[model samples]
Target: MIEIDELLQQEAWRFWDQSLSGKSKSALESFAADDLLCHLVGQGQSPATVRTWVHDQTVVLGIQDHRLPFVDDAQDFLRTQGFTPIVRNSGGLAVVLDAGVLNISIVLSELVQPIDISAGYEVMLEFVRLLLPEAEGKIEAYEIVGSYCPGSYDLSIDGKKFAGISQRRLRKGIAVQIYLCIDGSGSERAELIRQFYDIGVQGEDTKFTYPDIKPEVMASINELLGTSFTIQDIVIRIQQLLQHLTPKVISQSITEDEVALYQFYMQRVLDRNKKMLEK
Candidate 1:
């Protein structure tokens, strides 16, 4: 496994905090932004980047989610519950994102050497441990059964998951993204996804097995660690952590050229999502 320090041994690191970019910046844009960053980083046009983002009430669905028997009804249920439903251009089942969830994407270039998928996940897991030294040994990475978007890289404590890691590789760049439930009741969030699956599947078995969500297995970091931390507090921690890792931490937004690329990626994501939801 490539150590986190080894990954951060670069000359400089780019940092972008879009957590408070307002409600206009949807979660859809966040995924698109990562896609753009991945292309630039992979092409050696931009340094490795760490972007933090948060969205309002939203349920980011996976590709498989769009295949639910009654997906339209499930999405409508989400809308009636005051949450915007959008299919993410990545791998993972549905996940709840709101003001309290802090999403961090570490974009790395693999132009010179290929990165194994597990290595990418390991790097992000180690980085998360560094961010919260308080929960050093307690943070365990394993599949938390009965949790929404259950994966082998589920970040959990005492069997309750607080985060899940997903990866997107494009144009020789890898975007390792993790959404941390920083605040609120994790079980409540899990329950929402449980309901979504219930409505979408309608108890009908399918070729692809969906998770039988057990809300008790889900929790926020605050709930797991017994600490009161906000998204802003974690943002500061991320900056400090990166500053220690690299000599220079550049706090900049996307350039004009990047904006043009972002638009292209955004349209792709928008189009893909429109097609999925329309089904």
Candidate 2:
């Protein structure tokens, strides 16, 4: 695992805003570096970066998702319903994103030692448990059956999954990211994935395996806490915990060099998308 001190001092954190922060061209102009590696909260992140923004009503889809038997139909349904269908350049299937979910990025620089993907995930999960010790037992780290984006590190409570992780490597950087559905109805999010699978697969037996999503096996942190807790609230907690781990947890934005790199990366991401469409 890359030490916290090293991460704090490295150009990775100082370079880019992972994916979410590099929203616009200008934002990218200031927040990306040649070494910026992205770990998406869903499938893959590396080389450039993987970012999972917890925006409201956004449904992230895996590459195979674009190949749904009724691809256009599903896309139209999502579009009409105000859900943007974004094809991800990583592993895994469809997953939900919302304000209630806490999206985390494990940005990496190519200059650093190569850490195993599973190790990167463990580090992020450890940070979560460290940040919120009260929910130690409640925060289970195991694959929940019948969940979209099922993985070994799925964060769940009482057999309910609330988080799914993915990674993205680009150029030479890496971003390992995860989005945890906190403080809301996990079942609702699960139901969304369920519908996506139902509408996309339609009982097809392809080489890939799509999850038979179970909405009941998911719950929000709020419900688990028996109190109302927002993602922003948890963000503060995360910042505080990180501050404790280091003396200078500065809140600095990205630099111009990073932004230029982000533009290049954005183009690459777009190009990648174009290729998929062509196929």
Candidate 3:
């Protein structure tokens, strides 16, 4: 069995792609052996294979959105805005992204201990904290009431949510992914989610408790830090953490096998999107 140390010691593969490619997800899923852990920095999924490239003009909807009363109208709205609307299988509600947002993923194989959920979350939390240690104790994990995609694991500082984490597992492979609003106005994104819910829900009371979505509750790490936080800065921080940790890290390209796994994952994504559209 490959030890966790050996797994963490390996430098994470950073793929910079402008297009949403199956190869990226394949690398995270099939490329890794059963014991090797996987992480997708910006993919927004655990065991989530693809590092879905959400461009600036993209509007990502959550699964619950299919039931929306004005679904077609919402789709038309998206088209009018030149936003490519797509459905993501993860749990969060609608979230917008562009060049300013930083997405991360951590891939790890499920081990005997059963990778800790909080541990995985904290790993990303700690990863971000390492970037700006001054906010070490300040980075908090709690549902920021009224924030879009509000969850118990929302990462924030001084009451503003800046990042959210989710996990997915495929076979023995696990991928932990997160998106950080590093430079843009975080509240604006929150407001965007608020609008999505407003349109999707159409004021109907449903069993699902959608986030109240207070736009003011979220902000970018840069704004919260009083310094401009750039994706480039975060990229360096991730590399640094791997170097500083006890696990010796080695960065490498995805192998052929992982590519095969991603193909299946991509098919699932495509199928899911198709079913959602049919609804």
State which candidate has the highest TM-score.
1
Colliding residue pairs in candidate 1: none
Q: Model 1 Cα displacement at 49 (Å)? A: 0.3
Order the candidate numbers by lDDT, best to worst.
1, 2, 3
Q: Please, what are the lDDT tens digits per residue for candidate 2 over residues 103-162?
A: 666566554466666666766777677767778767778889898788888888778777
For candidate 1, write residues 158-204 as lDDT tens digits. 99999999999999999999999999999999999999999999988
How well does candidate 3 score on lDDT at residue 256? 63
The TM-scores of all predictions, comma-separated, are 0.97, 0.81, 0.78
Q: Candidate 1, after superposition: displacement of residue 15 in Å?
A: 0.2
What lDDT is obtained when candidate 3 is compared to the true structure? 0.62
- For candidate 3, lDDT tens digit of each residue in 1-279? 334444454333333332233222322222232113243322322222223232455566777765677767777776676566777665667766666676666665553345667666665666567667868789888888877777788898999988888776654556666778878788777766676667767877787776677888889988998877556666666666655764344444445655665455556666767787887
Best by lDDT: 1
Name model 1 segments beyond 4 Å from true. Answer: 1-3
Candidate 3, residue 124: CA error in Å? 1.9
Residue 50 alpha-carbon offset, candidate 1, angstroms: 0.2
